[model samples]
Target: MSYYDVDAILTDAEKVPCQFELDVPYLGHLDNSAGLKPGTALSLPLWLAEMLALASAGEDARAPLTLNLPACLSEAVAAALKADPRAVALRDQSAHLYGVGVRMLDLFDERELGAVLRRTWAVRAADVGLHARKADEAVGGQGAEFLRGLEEWERALFRRGHEGVRRAREWMDRVKRS
Candidate 1:
């Protein structure tokens, strides 16, 4: 089994265009869906997966999948990294030593990045004993490093000179806290 499945990304993006389009289906069913749920059929962002899981529990069948999933996911992954002081200390180290596939998006295309991230997720997921390993052996470290780096970048955007991203993060944080 390939460590990661491109079908995961495709399913997530295809069903919920840009996060905002993800609305509960009629009578709690996913209309226009291929019968895929967040955890089972797709590898959605962790936060999103949790959110859906929560919303699915309540009778309120109309929860909006926050449109800022990419940024939010980027932040969550960063938070996980920061939770461990050792990983936090790794901020700004070598690229491969840190968030390998994600931050490297600037160096490649969406398709390429997706492929790499899938394989990376697979490998790291396996390394950590979650799922199977992503087939592609990354040049440097595991795929989780990229997620950590993305989160770190998101954190720095708050503490760094990027006032807009910082403000946006603050507002989003407020909403999440509420």
Candidate 2:
């Protein structure tokens, strides 16, 4: 079975686009998007923005999007990462490590990174038993509950990131056979 089914788990999250004022022209087509003029602000999904930003940086070191995360979300991430320091500390930075996976998967379209993170997250989650739940609870039910409690935008971010990770894993499996 798959470790996560983002569509099933993230049904409650909305898709919020990130706004980017292009410093340089985006020459490629994005999801049938057209008329990408330089100096014009374009709104894109976070995953797309992240990928474009990285790709643009490589070509011109220009930032495609002016990204800003909310302060409360930052606090929530910090709190979640610090929730059980003793347990978290002994486990070798799993909290921050897990947070990184969540953040990267949420923001980017780097399949290799996602695949690596998928494996690392699985190993760490298993080591910590992070998903223990009653039979009545769905797999990752706790995470879903926690996600539901987040602010709308935060929930969206988490959902998007998880979907990225899932796609990455699927891509890896399809291409890695030798």
Candidate 3:
């Protein structure tokens, strides 16, 4: 995927903010340190809110943050997945769900949202008489196809990014070896 695709996915996933009210004074840490006072209203990223909700729930006493999931989430997911299984891009769908889920990992029960997306897509695909494909294969297939279709400069950017990551891994390994 191009940088634009990644950017779009992030932007879309973060568009909905999770709403919550702090019941206790929050000193705040790096990820969520906003110096929120008691009874203060805080609107944060869905992931962050979910995390805070999970954290507060672990405590024995009354929870500190009252977290509310977006009212439209279920509807939105259903509409998108059920509308057009073939028209929808599985990679983008997976990426969007992953971004949302990563932020709100603690909120999930038995099945994560990514798994839900996979299941939803599978159902839709089956309904449309499509063949079953592994989620990894679908995502990788898109990237491979995109790479093959990219222009010279785009291909170069992808290669440079790959090489940078490889070098970074090697450097970390060398440091560890010392």
- Count steric clashes of candidate 1: 8
For each candidate, give its TM-score against the true structure: 0.20, 0.32, 0.38
Q: Candidate 2, residues 5-48: lDDT per residue as tens digits?
A: 45323321222244455634444364344545555544454455
- Supply the global lDDT for candidate 1: 0.39
**Local distance difference test, each candidate:** 0.39, 0.43, 0.48
Off by over 4 Å in 3: 1-16, 24-42, 57-59, 70-72, 88-95, 102-106, 109-116, 120-178
**Each candidate's root-mean-square deviation in Å?**
19.2, 13.7, 12.7
- Model 2: lDDT equals 0.43
How do all the candidates rank in terms of lDDT, highest first? 3, 2, 1
Lowest summed lDDT window (length 10), candidate 1: 127-136
Residue 154, candidate 2: alpha-carbon lDDT: 36
| Tens-digit lDDT string for candidate 1 (3-112) | 37443333233222123334334413333564433322333444354355446445855544432223322444445444542333233432222233343343335553
lDDT of 3 at 117: 50
Model 3 lDDT tens row, 33-87: 5666555555565545555655655456545566643433355654565564444
Q: lDDT, candidate 3, residue 55?
A: 67
